[model samples]
Target: MLANFHQEQSTKSTLVYLTLSIDVARELTHVHLERFLAPLQCLRRLELVIARDAKRQFLDAGQWENFITEYLPRLITFEFKFSSEWRIGQYKLDQFRSPFWLDKRWFIAYDSSRSCLFTVPYFVPTSIKHSFVPVSTNLTTLPIEQHMVFYDRVTELRLQEHLRSLPYRYNHVKTLIIDTSCTYQNIIDLSKVQSLTVDISTLSLSSLMTAIKRSMPCVNYLSLNGSYWELSYMSFTGISLEQVRVLCLSRYANYQGDNTDKWSRLFPHVERLIVSIVSKSQIPLLIDQFKNIVSGFFYIDPPYIEPHNNDPLYVDPSYIDQIHIDAYNQIQVTHEWLMEHVNRFRQSNMDNFTYQINEGDRLSLSLWIGEDDKTAQVVMNSYFKKNIVDSMRTVRSKTENLSSNTTTVITDTSTTTTSATVTTSTVTTSTSSSTSTISTITTTTTTATSTTASTTTSITTTTATTVTTTTTTSTTTTAPYCTTRVTFDDIPGQSSTSGVVPNGYKNLNWTNVLYLNSSTMPTSGYQTAVNSPPFVGYNPGGTIVQITTANGTKFAFNSVIVSSAWRDNLVWSIYGYRSGTNLVYAPFTMSVINQTKISCNACSNWDTIYFTSSGGTPRSGLTGNGTEFAFDDLCISFGY
Candidate 1:
């Protein structure tokens, strides 16, 4: 494609950006890549995903430096990744340390155990699976103190072997998959992991469960992959995982027969289930088992059918026929069979149930059960209230259709007299003759009225008086001032001393912020500019910090206390978002010695808020753009 483009297009040399992903099965090298990119001398940025075996010649930093200098003189950014079947040694590390590579701040790291080499951060994959056993880095241009940058992009980590102490820490991994024991909790931030999959082969389930409850309190989606018989080896006498709302079981992990009760006790609050079942009868059984289950996905496997043993009279017409069981074994499951089972469950449970079935190669049922009785009642009540208001509006609209030529009046001198709206529905009246007072209450109407009253007494003479009262009800609701400040202290089931702010802390979504103890890093501004500390929130250099409502609802942004974490006079560019639109934007400057108050008195109804920092003078011993800042006591308001 590149050669063809060069041959046909005169603007090939004007290319400014390029991305190439080489297939793993293809034998590609630097020579082939050079032939494609060498003509694009004006390219400013290039990304390469190389999946070939790591040859020393291709991995040489000096070769790449020479190639870039000669062929791509305008290239400002270069990112690449190379993986091999065998380890690459450290012989080429010196070449990457030369002034040619160091001048551009392009660093590299190689994992010998995994036989992978990549540019630091830019080419780093976000997901990594590693054996917990110790490994070594055979080559790198990064200093020993800066090795953590190699794993900075990792968000999902898998541990496949036994645990051991490591030199680096992973505080950002939010989805963890483990096959060994849970002893490596200290290596990564447990509170950050919202989804976890456990398939321990030799670890004690009870101990692992205890660790999960004690350390990983934020995990809401859990997958247990062992078979029920294997999982039953450990007693779940006192364990209850109420935090897990979505649960998944591997195809081998069947919760049937005697293990149903045991499994129910373990995940008592599970609202959704994804599991495999051998028969359709198990679907209703599972629904009855987990009374709180609001939805589920059941992969129903066909029953084993014996080959060449078919009797013409024994063929069942309910689900399958003899023709479906030909030598090729193409099976068909009837919709009537599934509906029969579903109706049976509904008849017994008396719940509002819905289902959608896919009759493809893999038969699966997606069920959405009604909410529990209490929740259903609330929903039904809201629906009825809405309909009632709509009906009243319709009546008012119809009443206004009366013609101006039409009039209705009823008068009985012996008793009382009443008047109807002649041309409009805005006014109504009633009067009594025998000294009875007339009261008219006006509510939520567009017109204004005044009351008049008079009385006359004579022989057999009566007087009628009318009184009108006006009542105004306001529908505007004012949200209460935020009583709860995100102090980064006293977080439940987390270390208050130091940690990263989990996504759902205090009902707000946090991004790129760290929880720091005020006393631990006094040299840093995260501690120096504290409000209600011992704890505060900080961001790494050159990163934006974002705070948003977890449920995506608009809330009021009251104020926040902020300070420069690594510099003085840091400029913060603040933006507030409603849905995807920018609603508010402002800029503020901060100092290192004292905390600055950013008050958002006019900022309201924002679903997300984020800030970026730049152009700060670095403090002593600090370096770089000084785009880091610390914050505490964030105040927000919501209606409910």
Candidate 2:
């Protein structure tokens, strides 16, 4: 089986893949691993898990780095597993630093061991070069003199030492994470650490307050995942937090209800807050409390890991827990509530907000805060690089119709109302116009429709048919219309996000456009020169040449989603390129009906237009918070 696996991987040698193993197959040799990896040049992510008793002493980190660099030059994400088995004679980080590269910003040393002071080839944040971590379990803390500039670039820090561990003085941590095991002295003495996470499970509320007052007096950002809201309110009532800016509270489990406004009162000076509000009734109370708050990420459901298998049918659909059913149903009501409440938030000091709504366990809707261009661009790049929709073909939708054949005798039942939409059918068909029909054999006048457009019924005489049917019924019914579209399954360039985005046409007019490389966009030929400065991204961001002002639309490319600040409304926008040097812009005018006079005035010969709104409140459609608009997608339309 191992041999066959390597063979299969070798067959697809040109592809990139990930191998996630808790323990690699013992029988697989160096040759087998090489066979599987040699063919993969575009290995974007690679993760490996090695158990302690495993025969890993023979593995040289330097050798592995050489092998990866020689074969996979495109490896951007390498998640090396760091287990708790940090004894001497293990595969230390020193063995890898000789020729390999490790950037702190690109590395994340997760929970438990994040603060372990690895000595040899130390991954300390010194000189802005090594900004994150270095790993070696064989050693302990080095003398302070040996680590003079170690914590320079360390902007964020997490400390999870046991109560028995000796106190390690940190003079420069800006963000800090400490669990209940740490001594109160350590928490209270950390004057430099600003943002802090206080685990309610470990530390008592009173002790936490004492730590805040004595040590972390200047702490600004506060985040808590554990719950002890009642005690927290009592402990924080008189504590002064005049310098705090952001407050975040997340409920994991056993989250009992609270008065909710206690935090707002305790941290009256907080400018920004992120929370998972358990009760809708508390919203008005919060708005009433902090009137000048900046921004936040809000949701009702506590953060929990989804099960491995996401498909409902795999676990038997009938056995679905009611809790999940409730969560699914709560989304629509909660989302609508948040949207309506956004305008209310605007009345306060909030310039923009993001609403996050999770679409199942997969995708979500988040928009960037358009408060300022720089911050908005940061948020935009974060989300936009992810896949989004262009062609409607990728959309998942459901359709239902009220047919003429579904007619019944008008017994005239009193009245009916429903708070939710109930779906009894899943038949999907596109409709250009809404239509309804009624037909009956009883004493009722009815209009019936077959698959054909129109039909006439004979009642004694054809002329009498119309009159008799018209006289029999006095009531009429209309069917409801709705369109459901699913997005974020695909981002144009990345293959991982672009699922189900087939190139074929959903209709004759629309093509599911996709571009993985720059060569595929603008057809590789018509683009001549870039004239306008890029609006949202780094200079000439990627493979696609941006179509900006007066770069005559020769190949005729169209629209890309850009931040308002990135967009230049002066002359032209970056969407396409000029084809012929004669660069004759086929100027044309488009009139949106009812907004103005439906008239077209020919201007320049330009065929493409790029446009966007500059300022507005954006909701994070993903969580029903404000928008995480930073990660939106843009596309160029050939219009062919």
Which candidate should be chosen as best, given lDDT against the real structure?
Answer: 1
Each model's lDDT comes to: 0.57, 0.34
Q: Which 10 residues in a row give candidate 2 its minimum summed lDDT?
A: 591-600
Model 2's alpha-carbon lDDT is: 0.34
**Candidate 1 per-residue C-alpha lDDT over 1-640 given as tens digits, one digit per residue, 9 for 90 to 100:** 5445567777878886677767672455567667778889988667676676655566778789899999998675576777767565566766788987655546677766667777664454567787342223446775453444444446688987655666655655767888776478667878667778887646666777887778887777887776533446256666788878777764422333345556667888887777655544556567667778766665533353222223222223334334432333323334444445554444655444433323333344555565544221101111222232222221101011111132222222223444333223333333432221111111111111111111111111222233435632223223355655788886766674556578788888776566777675555566545667578877643345668899776787666767676666665556677775666555455655545555543356678777666555767653222356777777777642
lDDT of 1 at 611: 68
The reply for model 1, stretches above 4 Å from the true place, is 1-4, 24-32, 53-57, 84-88, 113-115, 132-135, 228-239, 251-257, 299-366, 370-640
Q: Which candidate achieves the best TM-score against the true structure?
A: 1
Q: List the residue pairs that clash in candidate 1.
A: none
Q: Which ten residues in a row have the lowest lDDT in candidate 1?
A: 394-403
lDDT of 2 at 186: 39
User: How high is each candidate's TM-score?
Assistant: 0.50, 0.34
Residue 48 Cα positional deviation in candidate 2, in Å, after optimal superposition: 19
Instruction: After superposing candidate 2 on the true structure, give the runs of residues whose Cα lies further than 4 Å from its correct spot.
Output: 1-122, 125-161, 164-168, 184-189, 232-237, 252-258, 302-640
For all candidates, what are the clash counts? 0, 52
Root mean square deviation (Cα) for candidate 1 = 23.5
Model 1 lDDT at residue 38: 83
